[model samples]
Target: MKEFIDYLLKFGDLNEQQISCITANAVETELRKDAYFAEAGKVVRQTGFMTEGILRNYYYNSKGEEITKYFVEENNVVICKASFDNEIPATSYLQAVTDCRLIIFPKKNWEEISGTVMIWDSLMQKIISRALVRKVERISPLVSQDATTRYLEFLEHYPGLANRVPLSYIASYLGITQQSLSRIRKNIR
Candidate 1:
């Protein structure tokens, strides 16, 4: 819980009162590997603060294959924002790739806490900004770079993702075929 609070503080300068409110209604849970934190077609009830382990956010393609969208590592927030915000069914899935230690807080609780805690509002803004920046980055090189170059850039940004996630998932995220990804890796090596 201290670690989760520390992470929140890193996003903004938070006072003790705000920190107290943030931690007040939170609950900690241990998620085993392969657990579904948030699933497609289900409304997200809680947003998680990952103290440890890896999580993947993905969506299904028309063919029903799961295509990885993003990976959240330790000290990151894991949520399906659209589902959480609107209380609607999710289009994406959130899953634990490793056994995880997480702090979970319901959206209702977060709203109540943030309503009183000004720092929490700032924290949410910062998080949104970061997500936007990452979206820009992911799309930019796809327009300007070759597939091999894009693959290299992906490695640069997510150093261990290729090794951590399955090859098919990584390939789908790269917008390339698994065979192409393998070729790119060979060329890079």
Candidate 2:
């Protein structure tokens, strides 16, 4: 939970009692590779802070193909913001790309912490703002870039991630076929 606390500290100040309450409300959990942290059409009951491994946010396209939207790696928050905040079914899925360790807070406990902590809402806002900016920075390039360029940019942006996740997922994120990604990888080598 130290990792999670450290991440929170980046956003706002927290006294020892506040930190203790936050920690007390959180539960440490593991998600196995290929497991869904939150599935499409289901209400997300918990929000998590990733301490290890990776998760892919994805959704099925009209043709029933999975399209990876974003990746959440260590030291990041993993939550379907709209769904969690509104208590609605999620439009996408958060799946473990690798076995993951996370500190999770159920909706009730999260609310309790928010109510008890003076700076909780402000801290969350800062974190969310940062996440939004990061998301835009990561995704905007893919819209105009060619497959090869997108792959290269992905590597540059998330070093070592290409090797850590399945090529199929990377291909999906790049909006290219796995075969094309393989060819790109081969040519780059």
Candidate 3:
């Protein structure tokens, strides 16, 4: 909860009372590895602040293969913005890549806090803007880089994430086969 508060503080100011109300409305939850935090075709009913571990946003391709879109590591917000804001079924799945701890607020509580707190909406806007920029920066290289360069950039950008997540997931994110990723890894070593 403290970590979550600290993250929020980076985006905007909040008084003790406001902080208290925000914390009171949130619940701490654990998601086991391989569990789905939010699933495709289901409304995203909660927003979470990740305190530990990683979650991957993915979707099934036309061939029914899972294509990893991105990863949300500890100290990040976990929510499908379009689904959560529009109250519609998600187009992707948010799955725990490892056992995770998160501070979560149900949609109702989130809206209530926004309504009651004057700065809440603006703070959220700032956070969302930062997230969108980071997403674009992270994704841009994948479009032009080759497999090995993409893998290297992934290592440089995420820093230690290569070893933390499954290679299959990393491969999926890089648009390559697991075998190819393995070969790249071996050759790099």
TM-score of every prediction relative to native: 0.89, 0.98, 0.98
- Measured by lDDT, the strongest candidate is 2
**lDDT accuracy of residue 43 in candidate 2:** 95
Clashing pairs in 2: none
- In angstroms, give how far residue 143 of model 2 lies from its true place: 0.6
Question: How much lDDT does each candidate structure score?
Answer: 0.83, 0.95, 0.94
Candidate 2 error regions (>4 Å): none
Colliding residue pairs in candidate 1 = none
| Candidate 1 lowest-lDDT run of ten | 161-170
Candidate 1 lands at a TM-score of 0.89
Candidate 1, backbone clash total: 0
Q: Which regions in candidate 1 have their CA more than 4 angstroms from the true location? A: none
User: Once model 2 is optimally superposed onto the true structure by TM-score, how far is the C-alpha of residue 128 displaced, in angstroms?
Assistant: 0.9
Candidate 3 — what's its lDDT? 0.94
Error of 3 at 148 (Å): 1.0
Q: Write the per-residue lDDT of candidate 3 for residues 1-189, one digit (tens) a residue.
A: 999999999998999989988988999999999999899999999999999999999999999999999999999999898899999999999999999999999999999899888999999999989999999998999999999999999998788899899999999999999999999999999
RMSD of each: 1.9, 0.8, 0.8
Using TM-score as the yardstick, the better of models 1 and 3 is 3
Q: Model 3: residues >4 Å from true position, as ranges?
A: none
